[model samples]
Target: MALNRQLWIAIASVMVIAFVSSLAISFQSARAYFEEQLHLKNIDNANTLALTLSQVEKDPVLIELMIAAQFDTGHYQRLELLDPSGEPIASRTRATDAVGDVPGWFAELAELRVDPGIAQVPDGWQQYGTLYVESLSGFALEALWDTTVELFLWFFGIAAVLGLLGSMVLKSLTRPLDDVVDQAESIGNQRFIATPEPRTLEFRRVVRSMNILSARVRDMLGEERSRLEEMRQRLQRDALTGVGNRGRFDDVLGALLADDDPNRQHGLFLVRLVDLAEINRQLGHQKTDALIKELATRLGTVAGEHRDSFSDDHLARLNGSDFALILTDLLDAKPLAERLTEAMQELAARHAEATSLQLALSAGRFGPGDERSSILIRLDDALARAEHRETTCLEWATQGEDVDRLHGSDEWRAILHDAIEQQRIHAAHFATRRIDGRLIHREAMLRLEDARQTLTAGQFLPWARRLGLLPQLDLAVAESELERLARTPDPDGEPIALNLSIDTLLDESTRGRLLGLLASHTARAAMVSIELAERAAIDHPAAFREFCAVAVPLGYRVGIEKAGLAVTEIDVLHELGLSYLKLDRSLTTDLAASESNRSYLRGITGMAHAIGLTVIADGVRSAEELTQLGELGVDGASGPGVPE
Candidate 1:
């Protein structure tokens, strides 16, 4: 029961008991007073009648006439005159009837019985006759009943007013408790929240303790996340230069290529220090390290500028005396190549007096259909050509080679809009299976069908995002998948994971549309899981948390895809209430080798499992890799090797 209700019940019970006791006492007191008054009247009337009879005459007829006259004038039940021998001389009596408007039960409860009055009649010192008179108690019973009714009405009215007032007071007093309950529920949902302290001392103390506990937990999570990020940086970054290490570079390069966004064009620059070994032989490792660090800084500066123009760009030191910088959305590599050439000349001039340290710069641009190995090979060939030509030379290969043949963003936007309106999007399923060969779930990949070609998400998502058409595309894809599920529910009852773009997930309008679509098809919600990229989740933690807060309760599972790349901050995962974490393919490739990778995966899996999240490895290529990942505690794997 609610606190307010319990309080009201108690208050009402007390009021009823008090009202009943008061009514009983008042009724009894009134009845006693009325009986005393009647008794006095009876005695006084009888004495007066007897005296009148004695003064009038000793004759029985005269006495009887006077008594009868008095009896008629007053309200009396019975009046009698008796001779000295105790024989009745004359008597008058009348039957009593209950008054109207009073219940029989109430009259009986309030009835008053009084004794009749007796007096002797005197005539010259001799007893004339004995007179007996009794007053009627029907009127007294009626008065008692009326007073009792009035008392009951007054008590009931006052008690009702008090009950309402008490209820209001209880509601106010317990309002803080409601807030505390909501706070507790939010915490259970992995959302740490605090409530204002109540006015009551005990309640305020409880609230304060909860707030303190919440803060402590948040602080602890923050510390753990910081530690994890530090570890990630140590594992992925070069010790001499603060740029990404070879492994990190390979992961980023693979991800960019695997993304296969047709509209995306990435520029790669490979810089080789021609005289690094000679410089180190002459000036020692210290000066060589200084030179490498300076070059890394310059490359980082260029990457930063490129990132400002295009959000996805990276600089990494692939190996000793060699560094690579990748730029996204740069269709032309000539401009960036020229900039690097100028920066290299300046760097060489700075080291002119110390040593003849020249730099060889080679640049290549890769796009949707380009393979990572081919791009690297072409970049290496360009570097060789630069080194052979001249000192401090820069060369560009495959320039203006991978430009898009389709229409501009506006036309593509129009086409995408038309496709969405016509519901031309379809979903492709890729299976992920557990170690025991049992099916876990199929990941639903979106495809946009045009008159000419059916484009995969990687081929069209970049353009869709650039054109601000992701929300529409996402809605269309979700609607299609839901319709499919409605027709044929998953045979294994496993949900199909659907990817959601960061913009679509965060946009309020898009979120509403998605929710409405899901609400209408609630039965399919349980068979649907929403997947957000790890980068997006890290970029927009608050938005992701809010999205999950709304989605999870509606029976939609939330998971993170491409985890471990941009997920240095693991604390957000705890707050996100993720159902699973999909290890990016870069993290899982060749898992049997590389102790460093194995250690990182172990740490990630442990952390995820601690928070009740299953870890699934993506892009598992071989049986060996799958077995290794399973041994490492990965719950599931999905890739070419895994059966569909």
Candidate 2:
């Protein structure tokens, strides 16, 4: 039984027992008083009758008439007169019909007994006869019944009022207890949350202890995240300028090009400092190194300022004099080229030693199916062309050969809107599996079929976000998956995971529609899980929390995808109530090769498991990597390398 119910039962039982005991004691006391009063009235009436008879004539007929009159006038059960020889002279008895409105059971329960009063009537110093009178108990019984009824009514009413008040008070007292239980459940689920202290001393102490635990876990997670971040920087970043190195750039660009989605396109820029050896000798090593660092910082600032232009961007130092910038889904390269040229000029002007410095800037576009070597060769050719034009020039390698698929924002918006309206959106399922080769779930990646070709989310998602059409596209995918789940007759069919953009989750109307759609198909809702990028939770913490608060309780699992990209604030998972984390491909690639990567994975898995979160690694390209991930405590793996 629930503790609250038990407490209520205990309180009710006590009230009932008190009421019964009080009623019994009160009734018994009232009954006894009524009996004693009856006895006293009988004695008084008998004595008065004897005195009246003694004062009157001692005729038998007269005595009999007096007895009848007294019995009729007073409430007497019986009246009698006896001669000196012990024989009855006159007698009067009351009938049983005189009992009033009192119930029989009550009359019996309150039945009163009193001895008949007896007195001698003397005539001239000689004993005459004895007069006997008994008082009727009907009147006393009726009064006792009335008093008992009144007492019962008063006690019943008071008890009802007290019972209601007690329940409310109990609820108030136990509310804090309920909050504590919820906190414990959250901890068990790997989400650490703190609750306010209750007014009750015991509950307050318990809540304080739990808050301490949550805070400690949060601190530990923060430290772990920092360590992972440090490891990632060491493994992927340029040691001198604090940007991505040649290897990291190759890994990222290779992954992009390797994707099957033809829509994966980006604008790439390669900046080379001309006559670097001469400049280095003139400026000395320290000043030249500072100048290189300043250049990297400037590129980082530009990327930050124009972050919205690209969904994903990379800035890297290929060598001492060569730097690269790749921006995904950039429709216009001329404006960014102009911005880069201005930044380069500012760098040269700021550093007086580089007044005679020359820079060659080259720009090109690459997409899926393009070889990494061919793209780099084209950019190199463009850099050589820029050198011939002047000391510094911006040269486009693909000139008129590669035009953007869409001309302007309006065209992009129209195409995306029509794609959604025409039902051109669909899903492609990729299975995620456990270490034992059991199916976990299939992730449904959204695909859009246009007039010319098919586009993956990676190819078109940034444009959709720019056009404010993500909510519509996300809903389309969600609705399709829900329909598919509903069509599957098996209740235990494999679950499917669908991604929702942060913008969709933030839109109030879209969120309502999504929740309503899921609710309308409650049975299938559980067979579908919703996912968002880890950056979503870190950027819009309140919105993510609100969505999870509603979605998780409605039988839909909520998780973070691409989790390890933002390792510094990943500890926010403790407060976001996420069910799982999907490690990004960069972290999982060549998992068995790098000791640093293995250590980072171990730390991530350990922290995630301690908090009760399932960890899944993405882009596991080989069985060896899968095995290594399993050994590192990853719960699941998904990629082309994983078998169906």
Candidate 3:
């Protein structure tokens, strides 16, 4: 039982016991008082009657008439005149029937007994007769019952009023305990919250201890998070130039290309420092490093000027004497390339005045769906052409003459619509396993099929998203996966995870359709897990939360994929009630060699685990990386190194 109920029961028991005891004592006292008063009244009446009869003339009829008058007027049970030898000469009797509204049980329990009064009457020198008088107890019994009922009413009313007041007081006094419980629950969810200390000394002490503990935990997590962020920056940045390193640049490029949005254009510029060896031989390594840093700074400035045009632009130092600039959505890349070339030339001119050094800049532009290797190969070819033509000659790759069957947005939309309508989407399964080789789940990657080719999500998803057809496509993928899961039973009974697009979650009709489909397949629903990108969840938290509210109760697990990219919003992890988080490949790349990345991963994994979320490392390319991830407390891993 709750404490409140227990308290009320205790209080009520005490009140009832006291009331019953008091009523018993009071009823006995009132009954005794009535009996004593009746006895005294009978004695007094007998004495007065004896005195009056002694003074009266001796007549039988007169005596009988006097006895009858007394019996009629005084409400007596019996009245009689007796001789000196104890023989009754005249007597009157009345029935005892007037006990008003008192129950028989109560009258029996509180019955009052009274003795009749006796007196001697003398006529001149001799006793005439002995007189006897007695009063009925029915009236006294009725009065006692009334008094008992009145006493009970007062006691019951007082007890009820006191009980209500006591309940209110108890609830107020224990209200702090509710706050304590809520705070404890929040802490369990990895949300460090504190409650105000109660005025009661013992409760106050307990609350104070809990608050202190919460604050200490919050401080520890905050410090660890700060250190991890610093380490992450060190791992991603080039040490000398403070720009992105080669690995960071590659991760960004892969993400951009994988998006596959045709309208999103990007330009890649490769700047090579010519005659770096000559400069080093003459001026030393320190001067060459300083020159490279200065060039990196200049590239950052040029990129910053066009930041609005290319929101996802970045600069990186690829290697010695080689730096690259990547800009997005630059429809006219020639002007930006020309401007960057001029900036490098200006730097080269200033450096030449002091030493014999030159800068050769080559620029190349690649559009959506272009392979990363092909872009690099084409940029290398352009750089070679520039180097052969002259020093510091800028070149741009010409658009290809080869045409795709789906040429425009309308054509691509039609193909995607038809594919979704016909359920042409298929899934590729990848296994995520624990360190001990136990399979956690299989992740599903969506694939689209057509007459010409089988396309990956990267090939067709961007077009679907651009055309507002992502919800339809995602629903189709889910339905197809559900059907497949129903048909193919896994020996291990591992669940299949499907990735959800932001559009699918935000669209009400799509969410409804997906939910209906899942609801129909109750057995298969339990075998399905949905993964949402962390960025998308953060962007539309209300919609994601609403989706989770429905999904979680229906036996569907929800996870956030590519989680580490949005570490700043890590608090949302608890709010979303996620089952797992997939660390982005960028953070997990080269984990075996990078101490900074390891420390960062440890902090992330710890924080996620504290919130009851399993952390899985993505793109684990080697056993060493997997081992390091295990040491850092990662729950599972999936990539080329792990078996499918």
Candidate 4:
């Protein structure tokens, strides 16, 4: 065991010994403290009573009966009357059930002793009798019992607190060992990572060793990674262009084509320089390489714009003035090619004027039904056909399909409007999450249905915005949803959350109507939460703040959605006094071994908690992500992991 545990055991044993010893001393002292007072009180009362009894002319039997009656009612230990001869005539002992019912073993253990009161009697200035009295020990027994129980209870409670503190110390000391192991494993597995050291001396030594080991292991892995990266560059990288070579591009294209879905076609754009040999003849090899490098730089800039559009797809330079891109999840093929050509032309125009060589891009697409080997043949043929073409960009068939998909945007607006008017709104999909088993968060989903078309937000919202009707369309969706909700399965006693857009906020009439309708359902509105995206939040901060100020007092709770994006303005969210905050999806999706995202989430989540705002992480799609969020102490979460 570590020193903390050893210290705990030693201190506990000493405390146990000290507690027992102190208890013994306290018991005896308590008896002495109360007994002294009890005995003194008895003496005073007996003396006063005897003086009073001396002037009385009652009969002897009556006097004895009166003294006995007082003892019966009072807390007297004993009462005795002696004749003028100094012989005991009448006697009575205290008979309270308090002392009588207690076990003798307990009374003896405390060394309880209650002194009896004694008094003198006088008849016409001569001694008549002596009175002996005993007060009840029950009060003293009760006091002693109370003191004993209280003292022991104090010792036990303090000892329990000490035990808890000792355990915490042990945990803190051993805590760094866990971090050390984690760092070691990360280093050994070729993950370059480090952890903070433990505070304890003994564990710090072990942690220092692990730190050194972790550093050495990381250094070794870094050296190895550098070596492999160089090898990869040498084998499949172009020396002058500094981009992936033809072999690498070939491999990437093969994999992308193989993975294409039947409904989604993948596009390949091959850009071939028309005059590489001509440029080399006029300019030396060095200047030709310089031009190619400039071309490569421009291509990279164009590629950066589409980086976040998809995953596992990349753009690379194949060879002299030749580049390729693998576009997946493409709904259609034609417009993507035209867009690529327009983007490249825009980027190309930025280069110095009077450049002899221009960029030529020829695109050939392969669908799930196309054979991989034949796709390359078609691409090569397209490149060959573009050799003498006048235009810099050309597409090989399927051009009209891209034009049709481009036109689909206008159709989406009509589709959304018809879905709302024709009562085609599908059943709402809402997800629920519990926090501390006390509060539940309901996340609402918008479902669209048509004979042959159903739309995801990603596909339809852009069209709504483009048509300048998103405000009207959003209200329609909201009204349809609420109208359907009002019909059956009301959201009473449940906190239901919905979203509002910037366009809606700009519309005074729609905003008033939306809030008015929601306010009518006061009970549900009290449990209702309205949310807006961070981009929209920042864009219309003034309007949103005003809206929230009015809505919140009307029994509505407001939340800033995609909160992780505005981590810098966490105080802005706090100032608005939000009831809940939903973290950005991208932040949660990037939580695997990413130091930046984890730190960002931690800081923002801490800020949210400090402001008394409920923190809900959205798009927690994995068990590992859920566990990580729980460890970070997120208030609640709703995603695929949460059941509907």
Q: Which candidate is the best by lDDT?
A: 2
Comparing 1 with 4 on TM-score, the higher-scoring candidate is: 1
Residue-by-residue lDDT tens digits, candidate 1, 39-85: 99889888887777778767777767876887788888899988889
Go through the candidates in order and give each one's C-alpha lDDT: 0.78, 0.81, 0.77, 0.65
Off by more than 4 A, model 3? 48-105, 120-132, 197-203, 240-243, 247-316, 320-379, 386-407, 415-456, 468-531, 536-559, 565-579, 586-600, 619-632, 638-644
Candidate with the greatest TM-score versus the true structure = 2
Clash tally, candidates in order: 0, 1, 0, 5
The candidates, ranked best first by lDDT, are 2, 1, 3, 4
- Model 4 lDDT per residue over 546-608, tens place: 787678767777887766433443224544646878875545654565554565566566655
**What TM-score against the true fold does each predicted structure earn?**
0.78, 0.85, 0.69, 0.46
Q: What TM-score quantifies how close candidate 4 is to the native fold?
A: 0.46
Ranking by TM-score: 2, 1, 3, 4
Q: Identify the runs in model 1 with alpha carbons over 4 angstroms from their true place.
A: 48-96, 120-132, 146-176, 193-201, 251-269, 277-315, 325-375, 391-411, 430-442, 478-496, 505-528, 540-558, 570-573, 576-580, 609-614, 620-644
**Candidate 3, backbone clash total:** 0
Candidates 1 and 3 compared: the better one by TM-score is: 1
TM-score of candidate 2 to 2 decimals:
0.85
Listing every candidate in turn, what is its Cα RMSD in Å to the true structure after a full C-alpha superposition? Answer: 5.1, 3.8, 7.1, 14.3
Model 4 has an lDDT value of 0.65
Model 1 C-alpha lDDT versus the unseen true structure: 0.78
- Candidate 3 per-residue lDDT, tens place, 143-262, comes to 888888888888778878887888899889988888888888777756677798899998899899999988887777777666666665677678899888887787667755644235
- Compared to the true structure, candidate 3 yields what TM-score? 0.69
